[model samples]
Each structure stands twice: as C-alpha cells, then as structure tokens.
Target: MEVASVLHMNGGTGEASYAKNSLLQQKVMSITKPIRDEAIRRIYNGKLPKCLAFADLGCSSGPNTLFMTCELIETVEMLCRELNHESPEYIIFLNDLPGNDFNNIFKFVECFKQNLNTRVVGGIGKCYITGLPASFYERILPTSSLHFVHSSCSVHWMSQVPKGIENNKGNICMASSSPLDVRNSYYHQFQRDFSLFLKCRARELVEGGSMVLTLTGRSTSGPLSNESHYIWELLAEALNDMVLEGIIKEDQIDSFNIPVYYPSSSELQLEIEKEGSFTLNRLEVFEVSWNAACGEEHNDNSEGYKVAQLIRAAAEPLLVNHFGEAIIDDVFHRYQHILADRMSKEKTVLLNLVVSLTKTT
Candidate 1:
C-alpha cells in the first residue's frame, strides 16, 4: 500500500474523526508532559530566542494536534514567567501525511493563533502555526530551524510495509503466526526508517536542541510476545473469519498487511546510537492498556467495543484503502466481537516508549 497516500485517521471532527477518538494519545501527551517541560526548561535556561521554530511530526488532525502545541506554548510561557525572561516569536509547524485533515485544523486555525497571542504575547510574544503535509521520515524544514521537536503516538508507523513478507499468509502484523523471516523483515525495516528519522532531524535541529517522542512499543517479552501482538492477532482472526464465510477473498488477506511495527526499547536505542546523530538523554518504557484512559463507566459498550473504536479511529483509513469500503463496517464489527471476547478473559496492554534526545551535530 502507498501508505503516505492512504494512512490517516478518519478526517474532520465528526464522531469517527481522530479529533474525538484520540483521547488515548492525549493521555500519552499528558504522561510525557514532565519530560517536555524539562526540555523547554533547559532551553529557557540557556537562551529563549527572539524567534524559534517548533514542529510536531505525524501530528494527525485532532484536538491533540493543537493540544500538544498548547502545552508547548504553555511550557515556554510558564518557564519565562518563572525565570523573568521575555517570551519569543514562534514558528510552529504541524506535520502529517498529505491525506491528513488539514482542513479540519484550518477551520479553527486563526482562532487558535489568536488565543495563543492573547494568552502568550499580550501583544508582545507572537506565535504562529502552519500545517505542513509530509512524512516525518524525511526533512520537513530547513537546516537548524527547529529548537524543539515533538511527536506522540505516531512513530510506530513504518514508512512502508516490510519487503519479502508476501508469503506470510493471514497476518497483517507481527504476530504468533508470523514466520521468523517475516519478523526479521519488520525489524530491519524499522531500523532503516528510524535511523533516517534521527539523521533527518539531526540536520533540521540546532545543536543542543531537544526532541521527545512517545509511541506504542514492546517490552522485554520481545516482538512476538502476546502483550505486544494481541491487537493484530485478534484483527487477523476477524479477517480469517470473513474469509471462511467468503465475505472477502483469502488472497486479500495475503496481500493486505499493516505497515505498523512496535519496536522494543533496545531496538529504539540501537537505532539512535547507530544513526550517530543525537545524544540519548533519557528513555522510558511504560505499559498502557489498548484501552488506556478509556473507562467502562462512561459508556455502555463492552471493553472490546471501546478498544475497537480506538484502533478503528487510528487504522480505519488503511483498511479502507486496501480492502475497499464495502467490508469496512463488517470487518470492524467482527473485530469488535473478537476483541471483546479476548478482553473478557484477560486485561492486556501495550508497552510504550518515551525517549528524550538532544541533537549533537
């Protein structure tokens, strides 16, 4: 699949839109708030430039897109207030693939900027935001332009599906059914993609500038572990059921695989070091439910229903692109039932990785 052309959350602020369904990622942003604040604290301690650049990559449309930006502005504002330093002008870039719902964000962009100006500038510190549609795997801005870069719940997406996995049947992601070679293909793909990410960011960031990334990843149990692989396992089972009933072709299963990988903490560190561009300041790994921050009391849906909504919001675009919209409803319907059944037995979660880095060159 041409993922860049296809991959995006359900656009607009409607019910299925990522704007409403991204609470899980908003929780991630909250979790990493301290780390982000610390990075900004250091920047302020050194120098709060008169003009600065900040970019959030894979910043899919949602309240979380502007939500993160708000936190960033707040961090600088709070730090300057505490330190008695005047605030600076900001060139904020919100980036995602071309298919992202920039229109949704644009609808309220001027209002958002005005709010920031009123709160931060007081007619003094000017803040600007622009939407840049492109993959974060490549350079998105001029060299040494960005002072702080942030991305949450996005880096796990591989730039493309792994090569040489066509023979691995019935599985869309790395799971128990995947062969050893197929797993290796995913690992190698992540290595290449993440290395290029760090290298490209290295060129874009000023020396001593910081970056913090939070995304779904794996634990010590490795890539094939149940905790790491259950989401896809259930999804594949749902598709296989459809195949059994002839709702979809078996070959479609073979051809359609998700371009997603959850890397281990070690895998992440290895790529950063091998890329030889940034100094890894801190690394954190935490476990959050596939349904994290989602509460049963708020809705009547089953746990599986909630989880399915979360995954569907983030992944439905890809499913629609590959399978056509005809089976979209049926696939998720079966997927919710399968996931609900699975969650009934045990509470499973994803291992999350948060890394803090500073550009050295």
Candidate 2:
C-alpha cells in the first residue's frame, strides 16, 4: 500500500487551529492523563527501566504538541523525583506525515528552548524534533531504546486507502455503504500496519516498555452509519452543486477517497492480541464535543472559523480530489451549515478511544 497523506482539517503551511484550541487541548489532557500516568508508573517501577527514552508519535506541529510533550515530561519527571530515581533521560521525538508543516514545529521548538532547562530537574534532557511517516517506524528510533511512547488523535488513520476499490461492486467512494467490506479492508490494513508498527517499535522498545495511544473510533458491528455519514454527504452535496455550476468535472470527484479508518475497541483489541508481544493495560472510551465551523454558540468574534479554515485547508487536497476544487468552498460552507444544524438539533459527538499497552519482557 502506498502511503498517502490523510485528509486533516487542521493542517496548513502556517498555523493549525487545533494547535491553538486551548479548550481542545484541555480536553485532550483530561482524557490522556491517566494513560500517561500509567506509562510513567511502569517506567518508574522497573517494569520499564529508569533513565530510558520517551517519544510522542505523530506529534504534529504547534502549541498542542509542545504542550503535550511538556506535560508528559513533567508527569514522568515528577514521578521519578518522587521515587528517588534518576530523572529519566528523555528523548522527545515529534513525528508526522511527510507533508506536515515543520516550520511551525520548528518555531515552537525555538519558543521552548529557554524553558527546557527549567522544566527538567537534573538538567534539560535531549530534545529532538524529526519527521516519521505512520508506516516507517523502524527508521525513527534505534533498537531497544525507547521506554515510553505516546500518541494521541493519530493511528486510526491508515497509511493509504484499501486496495481493489476501483473494481469493487459497491459504493467504494462513500464510507456509508458497504461498511463491512470497508471496515474489513481497513481492519486488515490496520492489522498489517499495526503489526509492522509493533515490529518496528518492538526493536526500539526495551523489554517492558509501554505505549499509550488515543484515536478516533466508532461503535457498531460494521461500516459507519448514516448519522455519521452526514458530514461526508454534505461535502459531497456541495461538490455536486459545484459540478452543476461547472466548477469541476464529475470524474474528478469519483477519483478521490479518504485514506483513513476509524476502528472499534474490539477490532483494535483483536489486532493487538495478534501482535503477541504486548500486554493490554487499559482501554477507555470518551466522546469529544467539537464546536462546528459555524456554530452560533461559538463566539462569532473569535478565531474559531480561522481554525476551521485551517483544518479545511489541510483537507483541501483530498476534498478537491474527491469533490473537485471548484466545490471545495461550497462543500466547506455546507459542512459548516450542516454541522451547525445538527448541533442545534442535538449535540454532535465524536467518538474516541485511548489505550495503553506494555511490551512483553
């Protein structure tokens, strides 16, 4: 499978909105603290050796990444100090898809240079920011080197879309119909990618090292449902309107598909079990409340829409490929409208999961 960039609403050349969304940041930390704490505990108890390395996979650029990394380091550092253990030598690795905006991340690094020494007890540990794709974990870290790994809002995205879709008999373009096949294909790909991830990370994680991962997820036997389908459909409808207006060709829309997947906890558990090298420590579910791009409740004077635009910009390539560039703005507008309406009718919720696992010694 060729690794392609996943459509992200919060991506662009400048700053990402999610990177600045303090509310979202707070919510992420609230859900991720327990997982981080557990990983720290494992590292402190000799379950994972002390003075070992730590990393944050898919650590996108921005305040969010900096905030997350600093928080994780603080948590681990505090635990080590409390236990009278040598503060673990930390290696902060920030990874993302190849196309991620590194400039912003670099800027963020500069902002933290002064505070780094102050944050660590003994001295500032080695901090490095580098890029790594979702598939090629082997190249990112050295063998048997990492003690704790943390990832959030990542990993549900596949390296690429499933194969054999062009010839498939059903609605291959839309994720609503043929969900079983879609999910199965997605599961298979995740199984392969995750297996490779473990294999790569396994080489880098010393005996008993642990990983904490959080990502978007869905619950149901198979395929995403209609309620969940509204977002895509609204975008699709906007694209169709653009087509009618002679903005882009219909064929163009048909050629594009999102190369991502949302897995259920059961599906993930099954795959992890198959890996056979890690022990599941904990799994938890939560719903994140996201204000729509055009929510009336949002302070209209705020920078919320700018953040939404950034996310849309990141997703533009995929959206244009699928829906056509001509309809992109319309699609976004319609999506915002639909999202607002849905929120008005009832709260729109996004499902997410956080899991912690320890490598077998």
Candidate 3:
C-alpha cells in the first residue's frame, strides 16, 4: 500500500474530522509536556542558537499541529526572561505526508503569528512557520539545521506494509492469531524504518540537538497482547461482520493491512543502539484511556462512541481507500457497539512511549 498517499487523518473541521476528534492526541501532548520542556531547556542551556529551527514531523492537521511550536516558543521566551538574554529568531517547520491537510493548518498560521506578536513577552523573537509535505523516513531538512525536533503519536507508522504478511488474513494489523512469521515481518519493518528515522534525524539535527518523540506502543513484550492489538481486533470484528453480510468481500479484508507497529521499549532501544547516531536520554511509558475524555465520568456507551470517533477520524481515509466509502458508517457503528460492550466488561487504554534523545557529536 502507498502509505504516504492514503494514510492521512480525515481532513477539515467536520464532525468526523481529525481536527474535531484529536483531543486524545492533544491529551498525549499534555501528558508529555514536561519531557518536551526539559529537552528544550537542555538545548537552550547547552548551546542557544541564533536561529532556532525546529521541526514537527508527522504534523497532522488540527490544533495539535502547532501545539509544540507554541509550547517551545513559550519556554524559550520564559528562559530568555529569566536569564535576561536576547531571544533567538524562530523557524518552525510543520511536516507531514503529502496527503496531510496542510491547507487547514496553514489557515491558522497568520492568526498564530499575530497572537505571538502580542502574547510573546517583549515580542522576543520573530517566528516563521512553513508547511513541509514529505516523509520523515528520508532526509527532508538541510544537514545540521534543526536544534529541536518533536513528534507525537507518529513514527509508529511504518513506511509501507510489510512484504510477507499475506497470510495475516481476517485482520488489518498484527493480532494474536497472527503467525510467528507475520509478527517477525512487522518487527523487522519497524526496525528498518525507525533506524532510518534516527539516521536521517542525526544528519538533520545539529550537534547536541535534542528530540522528544511520543509513540503508541505496547506495554508487554508480546505484541499481540497490547491494547492496540485488541483495538484493531474490534475493528476487524466489525469488518468481519460486514463480510458475513456480503457488504464487502472477504478478499478485501484478507488483502488490507495497516502500516503501523507498536514496539516495546526494548525494541526501540535496540534500534537506537544499532543506528548509533543518537544517545537515548529517557524512555518513559504511560497509559491513557482510549475514550480520551478523561476526568469526566461517562457511561460505557458514551465512552465507546467517543473512542470510535477518534479511531475513525484517524483511520477513515485508509479504510475508504481499501473498502470504498460506502461501508464506513455501518462499520464504525458496529465498531462502536462492540467497543461499548467491551468497555462495559473492562476498561480500554492505550500505552504511549515517550523517548528523549540527543544527537551525538
């Protein structure tokens, strides 16, 4: 499958758009704020650049697109204030695949800059924003240009579907019923993609540059036992129901596979070591509710519906490309019902892996 062409979140601010349903991703950014802040502090303390160029890879559309840019600017402003130092000029690169909603994000740029002019203390540094549509797996930036790089809820997506998972039928992702070969194929693909990611970033970032990445990951050593697997299982259940009803062909299910992998912390560490261009400073794992509506109490039905919307916004394009657009509503409706039943029996949560890294000199 052509992941870059088809794997974008639903665009625009419609009810099912990623813009409306990305509170869960925003929550993820919130959860990892301290780590990102610390990385910025270290970069500033170690070597403050005159023109700090930072890139947000896989910067999908929505409020979360510029969330890091704003946070980083605020932190630098605060640092400059505390030290009575001059604020450096800022250049922010918002990057994602070609199919991403760059137009939607750009619509808010001028407004964001105006806010910065008034909100940034002393109007410290002039900020520039640009939209870069490309894959992070390749070299997208000039060598040693970036001082700080941040990506959240990204990089878990492989560059393409693994080559030999043809037998992984009845499922769109890795599952417990998958054969050993299928699991190995997925892991090997992640190893290659992530290693290349590190190598490319090592070249793009300046010496002593810092990166903080947050990814959907598995808590346990076994890939299939994680919540992500179960989540896909639920979707597959919905798809299987459609197949039985002759709404979609069984071969379609057999042929479709999502190009995402949830690696364990150990797996990530190994890939980093093998790449040998960055030093791993911290790797933290945390869990959050799948519902995304934390702090408020909601019945299973409500929570389930919320989770379904979140996944639909992120997964709809890929599904539509494979199964056609006609079955989306019915499939998700069935998915919500299944998820509600499951939530009534037990809670569903997503495990996130946040890692901080420094480009080795």
Give the candidate number with the greatest TM-score.
3
Give the runs in model 3 whose Cα sits over 4 Å from its true position: 293-297
lDDT of each: 0.83, 0.63, 0.89
lDDT tens digits, residue span 1-361, model 3: 6898888888999989988888888989999999999999999988977788899999999888877788889999899888888999999999999999999999998888778768886775888899899999999999999999999999998899999999999988888888889999998999999989999999999999999999999877786564667888899999999999999999999999989899988898889888898889999999988777422546755877788888898899999999889999999999999988887777688888999999995
What clash count does candidate 2 reach?
Answer: 3
What value does the lDDT take at residue 146 in candidate 3? 94
Which 10-residue span in candidate 1 carries the lowest summed lDDT?
293-302
- lDDT digits (tens) for residues 36-107 of candidate 1: 998877765665688878899988886888878887888787777776877778889999999999988878
Error of 1 at 231 (Å): 1.0
Q: Judging by lDDT against the true structure, name the best candidate.
A: 3
**Ten contiguous residues with the weakest lDDT in model 3:** 292-301
| lDDT for model 2 | 0.63
Which 10 residues in a row give candidate 2 its minimum summed lDDT? 165-174
Q: Each model's TM-score? A: 0.95, 0.83, 0.97
| Model 1, CA-based lDDT | 0.83
